[model samples]
Target chain A: MSEPEKALAARSLASCHDCALVVRLPAGRAHVAARCPRCGAKVHRRKVDSLARTWALVITAAMLYVPANIYPVMTVTSLGKSQSDTIMSGAIYLLQHGMWPLALVVFVASVLVPLLKLAALSGLLISVQRGSSWRPRDRTRLYRITEVVGPWSMVDIYVVTILMALVSLGQLASIEAGLGAVFFAGVVILTLLAAESFDPRLIWDRAEASHARS
Target chain B: MPEADGREHASPAVADAVIEERSRLSIVWVIPIVAVLVGTWLAYRAFTERGPLVTITFESAAGLEAGKTKVKYKDVEIGAVEQIDLSADLSGVVVQARLGREATRYLTENTRFWVVRAQVSAGRVSGLSTLFSGAYIGIDPSTEGRPQRHFQGLPVAPVVTSDVPGRLFTLRAKAGGSLEVGSPVYYRSADVGDVVASELDESGNHVTVKVFLRAPHDQRVRKNTRFWNVSGIDLRLSPEGLELDTVSLTSLLIGGAAFDTPKDQDPGGPVEEGAVFELYPNRRAMLQPKLTVKRPFLLHFEGSVGGLVDGAPVEFRGIQVGEVRNVRLEFDADTNKLRIPVLIELQPERIALNSGGAVVSIGMDEVRRNWDDLVARGMRAQLQSGNLLTGQLAIGLDFHPDAPPAKINWDAPIPELPTIPSPIEELKTGLSQFVKRLSEVPLEQVGNNLNKTLEQLERTLASANALIAPDSEAGSELRRLLRDLADAAQSIRLLADHLEQHPEDLIRGKGAE
Candidate 1:
């Protein structure tokens, strides 16, 4: 094998996730979990059960996404007239009110981004489980993008909370968050946890295992 | 041997991966389970909070807007309009609303719904806040009847709702006049209630006015309480004098009713809700003592009955004992004369007889015997002018001993009372006698004597003028005698002056000087 083909695992060395300490591993006791010598964090070749954990969180997020879109996220009462709007409907309302830029921003951050993150995580999970030798660099880049963009979906939730706090003028005007906001917040948090639980190194592991087989 | 030594040393540093068999369920799976449980709970709560849908039909959709109008009870919102549709027959608009689950128990058959708008009525202004907040559906719920999901809306809001602590009373009137819903009801001139409704019965005979009397004041209503419409000023010119009566200023504008027990009557036990009472036109009419046992008597009057009218007081010894009911001119063909028949209702209750042992109420049978005795004793009915200014007349019952004796005619439809000629009839006879005396005087002889007397006075004035002529001899003789008498008087005056001066000087009377 070439020098680049010599992998870190083949050398039996691991870096601690918490302290970043490099340590040589003990030999041939696969049933026992390893710990960092310096910081004593659990050590593994890849995140332990990364696919299964990510699958569980991503499934939860997907389930929550439905109610988030179906139910009203917030209700705005102005001059005694109350109106309730869901996420997609809110964005559409902004569009209808001659605010296309705001509509685009809301649509992308609140709706499109979370959905795309869920899809990308699920894809990464399946590909890793199938032991695919696909382009590992591009797949890792996708994971990086999903992890970075997943939190911005909270823009809708922030707007709802801020409006609820600020626009309380009693009988004249008020704002209240609805049940969908709770579910939406759950989805955003779940997706974030799912992305954190995912291990990009598993993609390279799949590639290496397939390459070793070839 | 050297490769084995190096491998063994490397194995000490290299850790083997552990294939730990753990529960397949991950901790992360708990999030989804919790989320699912929460979702199920939310769904269940939503399902439970959902109330039944109700439909209300209104005559006009004046203040209703689909999905915008809210249903309120005492200003607290309990529901919202969901949809509005035209009725199948196109008679009105049907509104569908969904209420909160808390309101389910109050949806009853007697529940009333009405639109509350800014209304300016004769009695007062209401719902002014609705002008700014827009109209809303008002509900008066009653849990007494069967559960209902449909209702017919009232065209106007009821003046008094069932929620108010009050008793509903019914008043029957010959005419409604100015009374209407929202009119005030007064107890002794104090406003204590409102007219909830005024409607004509199916037969259109009388008006049925439903009034609500608020608590405490409602308890004042008794079985014998009199209700009178004090809607306007009551001005009357009677023998008592010009009098004006009114309840209050509000009653003058919006119309109102007042109730009280007559002074002489007993205010019986408290009346239940919806007790019916007669509505008199005025307080005087209501205060007129009601005598249940009335005996009607007919009188044939020989004099003019022009000034008497129906309802004129029939007085015994100047005290009102009855009322005149009817008066008609009938041609008595058998007698070949015209007669005036007057029907009078006499209340025996007004006359109490002290029978030495106890005061006995006069019954009809007793009244018959009494009438026969009185008529034999020359008790007669006469028309007397009650008010000379108004020229109104009243039937006066008195003992006219000089009247021709007569007995009660029991054979007539109504017992006939003996009648005597009124004073005006006596004056007519006296006036006719004077006219006859004036006509019987000897006019020709009186005119001749007056002419002779006038001629004699003219002759005497002519002789007196002739005696006073200036050129006659008696005038010249009188002039000479006057001159001789003046001279003689002057001499006598001189002598008397001398004597007076001497005597006054001697008596120290200096007045002579």
Candidate 2:
């Protein structure tokens, strides 16, 4: 094996020690499958297609979001009469009725939180690609936040669902779910997948290697 | 030892590697995407859900719930309560409502809003008429005006007294009994309108009540409409019988307002807004001239005058023209006189019914010019009892064209009205005077005259007696002849005895043999 390969194998073996796997270095820089020598188990490495798959899913979700907002998310009918309202209108209605705090919470959960998570995840991804050596702790915290907040982005959608279900008044009044709900659901799922597909090991590897050199 | 050291070194690296990994996805794009969806949805809703916004101000917002109340037209829901807010002054609650897009066409500047609840009345009327119906805003649309933002609260319920439209007037009174907002209003004896609302004014001294009267009937209400509280039975002794006068059976139980337009005047201009009227009692004793006429003239009177009483209405012709002022008695120059003089003032307009005269002209072109002559020729003032059973007197004037004119001495007699004594009083005085004249005849002088008459009768009686008495004869002169005379006397006596015994024999002369 070449000296660099030996060093890489040694690092991989050391990292896998807790799992009962000792990696063996190959001679050249070509990709090779390594197994833990101590436990005779195959070591799993980050997938080569992970980032692309996540990017595809997130971009698809992003595209769907446009139509979701542009169309009404719910249709309400009362006594043979039909009407529709969107998120902003609903919030404003609540505010006008002296439900300000509730309105604020809904606004943040449905709009601001989702957007923040998206931006943060994107930033983390870009930094990871450029091999940035910035504050690793902060980036880790940011990732954690994105993952945690991703599911909550469905708050508006859930609210719509519940309202549509509860407010069905037969002929007197009724509520129907709309296209915006589907799009919002897509955003949540895609964001969650994006967060999951990210590889944290890559961050520590670079960080530790630089620390060793220093 | 070397492997252990390497493992420790790589552990830190593994942790760092995990942090460094990132997804290739550009998640930032999701924000705009979601925003666009929400925004588009909202815009569509805004375009489709069109409605008019109306703001109503309320003094108290005790039971109002935002997003719950609704605006209704003809009991059909047209919109919903969007929100509620405090007025800038914090003195009231301002409610904002949003009607459906189609409903916007119906909203106009005349729309009204009010709170409704159950009300109780002392007249034994109770219950919730509008319960389960919920509080609703009402609209009265005007075709000409644009939609307005601010609206006045019409807290009063719609009055449905009559079908015609007319100006509404309000009145206030100290309700002797309980009264309700929807009480009926009567004019003369006809039902004209109803009470719309009753509320205490700021001063709280009186309760202002709103009443509505319908069209042609409302026109009957003139400036001189006299309002009286006619809610109870009024007992009046009319000439016919004991009269029970009441507006209505229900009004007698509860209470209501009654007014009348004077017969003479063309119904005065429509009742002015916010006009206040006094409430007169239904009793005849309370029938005094309205304040408009009280200030001008004051007159006094005395005696048992025939034509006037407390309620004896003064009349110009046969029509009632004025009223009696007072009735009293006075003593002048040690002579007691029953005096009753009436103070009569004519209603200038009613006086126009009489003929025109230089001194009493009423500017009526249609009036006959010789009014004084007509009055002198046709009018006769007399005392007429209201009801014989009740003994209430009323002065009546009648046209007595054929009857001789009253001997009213303009120059010699007292200027006051002659005291016409009541029949009972006249009978009593005549009887007493007859007794006095009889008692004045001298009984003692009559007794003396009777004694003189008796003495003269006795003297005449004595003279007659002396003539009838027996007398002495020439006696003893002829004693010698006594024997012969005796013999003759004896013979005569025998004959006299014989004649007395037989009168028929004497006429025949048989005793002389």
Top DockQ: which candidate number? Answer: 1
- Give the total clashing residue pairs for model 1: 10
Give the Å shift of residue B506 in candidate 1: 46
- In the order shown, the candidates' DockQ scores are 0.30, 0.05
Clashing pairs in 1: A25-B13, A25-B14, A25-B15, A26-B14, A26-B15, A27-B14, A30-B17, A30-B18, A30-B19, A31-B18
lDDT of 2 by residue, B411-490 (tens): 43232222233344457578879988877877788889988999999999987665555441333334546888889999
Tens digit of per-residue lDDT, candidate 1, span B47-83: 9999879999999888678777899999999999999
Question: What is each predicted model's overall lDDT from 0 to 1?
Answer: 0.85, 0.61
| Model 2 regions more than 4 Å off | A1-214, B1-34, B40-58, B64-112, B122-181, B185-242, B245-310, B313-339, B344-380, B397-419, B422-425, B431-513
DockQ value for model 2: 0.05
Q: Looking at candidate 1, what is the lDDT of residue B83? A: 94
TM-score of each: 0.79, 0.48
